[model samples]
Target chain A: MTNQKLYHAHIEACVEAMNACNLSYVANLKEYNLEKLCECIRITRECAEICSFTAQSLSQGSQFAGEIAELCAKVCEACIAECAKHNNQHSRECIEACRHCVEMCKDLMVAA
Target chain B: MTNQKLYHAHIEACVEAMNACNLSYVANLKEYNLEKLCECIRITRECAEICSFTAQSLSQGSQFAGEIAELCAKVCEACIAECAKHNNQHSRECIEACRHCVEMCKDLMVAA
Candidate 1:
């Protein structure tokens, strides 16, 4: 596939994951109000946000895309570890998404 | 301000800008399906997402906070430029937000 196509595929998957995590995080926040999980929630939220912008940066062929992608991978790792602690379906789904994004971030970083 | 307080202040402003831009972009997407603006839309979405995450990361004292903030600044620059093309109230508002984000990003990158 062309770089453009590759970008779309990778970024779309990551974006999907980020979106899922964001939704799940919001729902959990409302239902449980677990202030203790605030740290985890913060990590997840940041990872989701980074993934969103990274997708666009990748597509636009931004010069910083590679550097950013690498940073995103680190962020995703923290998020995945955090989500693993929660046993909910939402958290599981989020973990799955973060894994996918982590893979994409690694790949993009190499290409960049 | 304490790092904690500073983080809240900076990230909050950036997040506000990002959220404003995201909402405006969604509304614009519905009213006008401009394929040409797809690039702009993409940038807006990414920046918004990143801003959200960056805020969380900043609050938690993530080690990569500085690097991510730098990336956010780059993303915000592109977003601001794109938003400037439109004269709509939403676009205008988005541009203003992006400007605030860019400044915060620069500062955070330095402190990081």
Candidate 2:
């Protein structure tokens, strides 16, 4: 795939993951699991922001693309691990998205 | 400050950075500097997502809190470095936000 296409795909996946995690956290707020809920929101937001940045950076192949991709993979992995602790559907979906994004970021980093 | 407060603040800063970077890229599109634009988007997205995730994790102190914080700091630093390369106001703002978030994440990690 062209660099632009690949980067776009990666960005979309990252956004999806962030949205999933964010929605899950908000929807499950009544669960009253403050700790887990908070973690979910924070991690989701983080992923969403970074994914957006990475997408933009990749579009232009900035001097920082390779470095950003490396960091993106690391953060995505961390988010995935955290979300996996919860036994809820939302968490599960978020984890899956994060994992997918992580793989994409790794590929991009390698290509960079 | 309370963990929740700190996490919230960090998330806001991260979001702001992402928005700034995104807007900058869009506004400067006529510049047609594809490589720089792409990189900005990618890095901004990545930072935003990871920052969101980190915020959530810190709010609840997940089992992965410390680990996530560590990763968050690293990613934020990377993003800051990338954004700093540009002389644009948007990039400078992003760099500032990322730096702020990095410090906050570090504090949270230490407290974790």
Candidate 3:
């Protein structure tokens, strides 16, 4: 696939992962664990934002692609760690998605 | 402040930063740059999600806190790089917020 196509695909994957995290948070809301749920929401949102940005940066050949890649790795790691806490199916899926995105971001970073 | 408070505050900051990024993306929509705008939206959303998760993880002293911190750093860096391209007020603000969040995440990672 072309570089642009790859970047777009990566961003879409990240978005799916983040959406999974958000859904998990919402699902957990009824447990009155607002604190935990809220935190998850925040992290997932942040990851989604940066993932989107990284895809755009790559598509445009932005000068900051390398820097973005570095950040993407860190964020994905953080999200996975957070989701790992629940030991539930949703969290597990989130962890997997985050790991996938992290790897992609790292590859993009290297290429940049 | 207590560690819990600190974690909460950090999450809040990250949420704010991600929100800023999202708003920027929306603002740029009028330019018919769906590709760039969509990418930014996705990244901001992801960042927000992960930031929320990290805060919760730290609050609960999850084993994954360190991992989450690492991820946060990577995502923030990526967001900053992406936003740097616009040279507009919103993008610049997002970049600054992202940098601040990255620093916070790094500190959390070390502490974890």
List the global CA lDDT of all models. Answer: 0.76, 0.65, 0.68
How large is the interface RMSD of candidate 3? 14.4
- What tens digits encode model 1's per-residue C-alpha lDDT throughout B1-112? 2366668778787779778878765655554335445456557777887887788888877888888888888888888888787778888888888888888888887787
1 versus 2: better DockQ goes to: 2
Which numbered prediction scores highest in DockQ against the true structure?
Answer: 2
Chain B TM-score for the candidates in order: 0.88, 0.76, 0.78
Fnat of candidate 1 is 0.00
TM-score leader = 1
Per-candidate TM-score against the hidden true structure: 0.50, 0.48, 0.46
CAPRI tier of model 1: incorrect
lDDT of 3 by residue, B1-112 (tens): 2357657756766677667766664565444444444455546656656766666676775767678889977987877777776767888888887788888887777887
Model 2 gets an lDDT of 0.65
**Model 1 misplaced regions, further than 4 Å:** B1-112
- lDDT minimum window of 10 residues, candidate 3 chain A: A29-38
DockQ of structure 2: 0.05
Candidate 3 per-residue C-alpha lDDT over A1-112 given as tens digits, one digit per residue, 9 for 90 to 100: 2346556766766667667756664454344444444455557656656766666676765767678778878987888887777767877887888788888777777777
Error of 1 at A40 (Å): 2.0
